[model samples]
Target: MIASNSRAELMQSGLNLIGQALSIFDSDLRLAVANRQYQAMFGLPDNLCLPGTYFEDTIRHMVLRGEYGPQDDPDEAVRIRVEQARTFQPHYLERQRPDGSWISVEGAPLSQGGWIAVYTDITETKRQETLLRARSEELSEQVLENAERLAAANRELAATITALQETKRVVTETQARTRQVTEMIPAHIAHMDRDYRYVFSNRQMPQVFPGTRPDIVGLTGDQVLGTTTFAVVRPYMDLALAGRHQVFEMTHEESGRRIRIALTPDRAGNGVYILSTDVTAEVEVREALTHASRRELAAKITSGLAHDFGNLLTVILGLQDRLTHAGLPLEAHADVQATLAAARRGVELLERIGQIAAPQGTALAPIRLQDLLRDVVEMAKATVGGSARLTLNADLPKERLMLDPGHVQDSLLNMILNARDAMGPKGGEITLSARAAAPWLELEIADTGPGFSPEALSRATEPFFSTKQGQGSGLGLAMVFDQAKLAGGTLRLSNREDGPGARARLRLPLRPVRPQMVLLAEDDSELRKMLRQMLIRLGHSVIEAASLAEAQGLADLPGLTVILSDLQLGDGLGSELATPSGPPLILMTALPPGDPLRDSATGPVLNKPFDAATLAAAFTQVTHD
Candidate 1:
């Protein structure tokens, strides 16, 4: 609105600078614009000179004031001129007013509507022509006067046309720039008409909702957003159309992305403007933080109770021992034993609660999934015994996965043990399966047993909510849930739909040890600095070494993926830093293929003059012994 008003002010200022009187009428036969000279020349009141003043009213005022001339009936005279103006045709006329002043009016029709008229006082020019006719009878008086007036009108019309053309060009360029800026925004920006039909759109809708159309102009909200999504936002849309702005969020079911929408009503009551952005990542982070805070509070509460609870358990155990030594009766002895067992179990439960609620940093490393699975199966055998058969199905990628081996193995065992217990004495087949889910590693353990009850399904992950009668602690599922959360993954418990059984599935983020730590060993300062930059750009935390001795010292540090070294070190060959039980070694050299030194290098060697692509490719070969 500010920009529009500024432009209008600029145009008015320019029009007022013109010496001739000028006025422009819109298609509605109302004044759209008038210069200061126009008002002064006609002696029009402020109301008649303002935009939206009807042409008939101005004409009637002029007729009443005898600006044109006295008429037999002024009303009829005003009506005839008003009707003529409505035709909006090109015209030129010269007339003398009641004040004995002559003026020439030249009007040209506008393409959009109405006409623009420029009025020039030609009384002095007429006097010069009359004098010339009297002084020289030989001259053609009528021809000269007509030629002079025509030339003057043509000059003014040309200037007006040029100004209009410039204005049109500026408007066109401004509109194009606005559209480009809107399109560049990440979120969808669009405008709708009175009937909820799209009138303008920046074509960003498809990016927020994958299945929606990008070119949504001309389509109604319901048609563009589909029936389901349209229903979800219809209430907000109605509010905006009713002049109330709204901002809200909803999940786009088809894309499974969280979408935040903002609606602004048009001031003219025409329609609404909309902005929609995908905020799935933001929502996930918020939920994760909220859950973490709750867990922290739980840990504090559990930790505070531990000291008192430990003392109570010790007293109970001492009393049970006293009863045993007292030679209590056989029936009393059973009751004493039961009491001791309950107290011991309570102690164990308190310990488990603290462990599950406490926060722990994850230790991630590159691991061979197959080897880990083998180890888990071997360990689970002791828990399941000979009654149940353990089977493994892995469809994982060949690349070593990044994970905390201890936590993952512990979680897997927890699920497997739960499955074993669920199957009871009838011990059924338990399948441990693994697969890749892109950014995540998916693992599932399925057991052939009675499916989970509805109530168990809902509360299994909650601490101390066991289905087992008095024999279970119920912390197994809760521990698994925490491990997954710590790893920024998820765990789900569901009964198998195929048959009578239950399944525990886990998904952990697929990252290479949280951006692999790189130990760059190079003797040359300049070369080492260049290599470090490349490593950092590849999302690695780089630790630099200037010599083989420095490299060896750092190699022992944990979490290093590989030792990237120059073949020639200041003190010794980089090959000296290589060890059988250490991080993989990658050597860089400028030597040619035939050089003895290059051939002597056992580990992966990269030609020194290499780009990031070649440097990155050398990492794939770091699996070398």
Candidate 2:
């Protein structure tokens, strides 16, 4: 693209190299383009030489300066010339200027709604022609006339060629600009011919699908997309080739991303234009919204039933109590008591159902993720017992995140139990893992059992949709989905790629605990200012320190978040602040990872030249005491 621009600039430079002054004006008589020679020849101001300058303005300036010799009415002359230019035509002409010099004006209309005019000084040529006519008696009147006409024709042809070249350049630039605009769109734009070969591409395919090639023009679909992906898209490609446009979505196995694709069939040719967008995040939000809608619908349906059922249970309980008190046979008394117990159980169940149906606000509080995961593991193991073995993989940086631990634990337990049931009586291994996919905390549980069926995959999160064959309430996953959406998160269901198992992924926003005050320590004044701003941008009040000694003194200040200091400070080592007795410390270092000083730091390390995001991450990386 840079090369293309450079070549375009070079072409403009080439235009100025011509001796003849040239200018192209659009149909509206506004200057479309002009060469340097044109400005120089007319001695026009820069603004007049620029594109969008009115042709009338240039003509008026010339007329007022007496360039066309004395005019009785300069404005009238300008108006007449402007009107003539409005209906411009191809022509060739020579006229003597007020300076007593002759020049030729040859013009041709452009194909794309414009006309190009070229001006060349013809004083020397005209003088020679006059000399020939006066000095040579052999020269006939007819011969002189022919000679002049030939010269004029040659000049017109040269002007026509120059106009065509400018027209081509304009068209190329327009196309380049259009292509640039298309590239800016956050989607893969491409064109495929009837042979399933990419003929044009905007180089966004690799971004949409992680492993795909970017320069895909002239490559076959399978070659660029790989066998698996091409297979998924071939059916749609066939439909597009059959002249039917299509818009659909498919999960990319390689990247584990969801992409929405639109194929537009060319009306003039057997080709298809493809626009594919990586809509993974968008799909997650859509699913969250869909789950919320279903929950709303479930609440609406359950509200009335619960009300009626509660009143009916009350009537049954009253009768059972009456029977228990009244004189009756011993066996009959046992039956009355059993009936009373069943009625009470029904009332309790109704209350639990109501709690599930009603919306609940999120309890946002600072909590350690490691503590949360430990509690989840302990609870899950007690339930799983010997039914299945449990494995936990937690890869996380030290950080305090905001979450509702109770609700989150309940959701995890639900998923674990479901995985246990799916394993059946024979039992299987259940692996639970947690990691930061940034912007999201991803908690996943997988089991060594048959994966979810197609029907189950599509309807699993819907209320009253279950796969337990009447043994379950079908609301476990629904509740999990509800909890996620309430906290601005999402739940995804998939099969494990490595083996036969089901995977339930819960993603929550990775919001770390934001402190009220942050202490920043750096030796350099410039870097210190930058770090202070970063802390302020993260909504934390900052206290500055120029050395480790200064940082240690302020580290114990009340309400301090942490001491963010450079490892190699002027006075002392920043590593000393990482002591258990001091506040949480995060070290920023320019030293490489292999350097002993960097590796020896007893806190999270932030490499030098980091941005706002890195600073935010560093805050999360601090291990709270």
Candidate 3:
């Protein structure tokens, strides 16, 4: 009996060890039978007869907390996890064991009614998980903030690009406008390479030289004006190409004008900048004013001298003629002839002096240019002598021009004679040409001889300034200038670009004239007939009247284009015609400059001795205005 009891005790001990081997939460909760671990772990009573401890007080207390019996309550939180039997997902909960140790309940549902649960002390794992989650949240917020900053930067970049584009557009437009303004300056501005090839030019260059075919950009003067112009300027260009600046004057043969040029070394040392200015008008004006004063002074001197000599010559000539007609002695015939010759020569000399001293006024009429040129050329050839070749080339249009014929002839002849004198005894060609020059007519005289030097060319037309010794009165060109001024024309002279020569150009205004009927209302018979004759000569049909009633009655006549009335009328006309039916009116008078009729005349006011061209120009100005 002792041996058997020992055996039973040992067997019991082994079973208890097997049951308590696992953690408390690792026990199987689905089984209804109480294993030794469950009974020992909960301190169950030793003599329990029932398989289910439903009536036990300890069981009741555990059931209230949903953890009672061999199998926990079905609806209890812990038992519910066992009933689900979902093994793929692990579930966990925290608890405090009675032993005062922190415990974690972890379980996975099994295929059976129970779950495999383990009670573990896992406080450290929970703490680490909490730390990792906090760190992740902070990192997520930081990422979101950085993304916002990056997006804002992109927007700023886009706005900056847009602003830059707008600024670029504005800069481009400003540069273009600046270029336009630079080109509009009235100078022959240009650039060129060291070889003298053109690089660029302003618009004024082509405008000044109308027929110039030179490509101002990328062409040498030799290429445009041929080797002639360049050959003449080779030294200056050579010096400029060697990096020296030069200021020089050149007479353009093609335009028959003078231009002053300034050349400077380009920035790269391989080019040049040329600035040329046309000083023709300014130079001409200065010369004109200077010569005009000298001519006036010389005229005063010559007129006084001629008047004194003329009286003496007139008395001598009259006495000589009487003596010759009286039939002096036969031996005195030779003496008589000698005296007559001396008197004739004296008279001719006086006539020459008077021609220079006379201050003649312009008397304009419709003059045929062809006839006028022919007559002037014939007279000039005779005066210039046979040694010098005189050629007159007239390209006159069929239209008749209203001009002062005498003044034009005298001016043209004077120019030819000047050319002749420049040729001297060597005898060069003198060419006088006339042709239609746009709104004007051009009279050009070119002479092939030694051209004027720089100083002489500058002051050629100045009064009392002459290159000739003793023979030159210096009044020929001065008188020509006066005639040009009187005719509303311009004169130009410069050295010929081709070789050595000089050319003089005169541009005269020309306009169209219309023939129509005119009603002349005048109180003076002499003035009426004089104007009537002049009007008839101008191809106008004139209806003359000595009184205002006769003029008003004649206004009914048809096809009248003009009405001429006297300012001081005897028939109560007084200068006002009551706004005549259909024609423009003109008032004629010998009134002073401040006369009311002169200022307030409705149409045009013609002063006494008013030339036809002036009247026509005034009429055109008034009607057009």
Which RMSD values do the candidates have, in order?
Answer: 15.5, 18.3, 36.9
Evaluate model 2: give its TM-score: 0.53
lDDT of 2: 0.80
Cα lDDT of model 3 by residue, 195-294, tens digit? 6776556545655444566345546777755675667667877788888999987765455456777888865565677787877677667655665666
Whole-model Cα lDDT of every candidate shown, in order:
0.81, 0.80, 0.65
Ranking of all predicted structures according to lDDT, beginning with the best and ending with the worst:
1, 2, 3
Per-residue lDDT of candidate 2, residues 316-434 (tens digit): 98888888889999999999988888788778656645555775877655567888888888888988869699989998767567677877888889999999999998889998899
**TM values, all candidates:** 0.47, 0.53, 0.54
Clashes of each: 0, 0, 2
Kindly list the per-residue Cα lDDT of model 1 for residues 1-625, writing each as its tens digit. Answer: 5686687688778878777788887666767678999999999998788655678999999989988777899989988998898888899999988987899898877765567788888787677666676766566676577568767866876786677555444534555577789889999998876677887688899999887888676678889988988999999999898899999998775554789999999765768889999998897687567656656766887879888989989999999989988988999999999999899888888877777677476666567788999999998998897888889999887766667788999899989998998999989999999988665688899999897899998788776689889688777887788788788787777899799999998988764323558889887799889889988766678999998888888888978878888899889999887889988888889899989989999978888698765665566446421
Superior candidate under lDDT, 1 versus 2: 1
Clashing pairs for predicted structure model 1, backbone only: none
Q: Residue 289 in candidate 3 has what lDDT?
A: 68
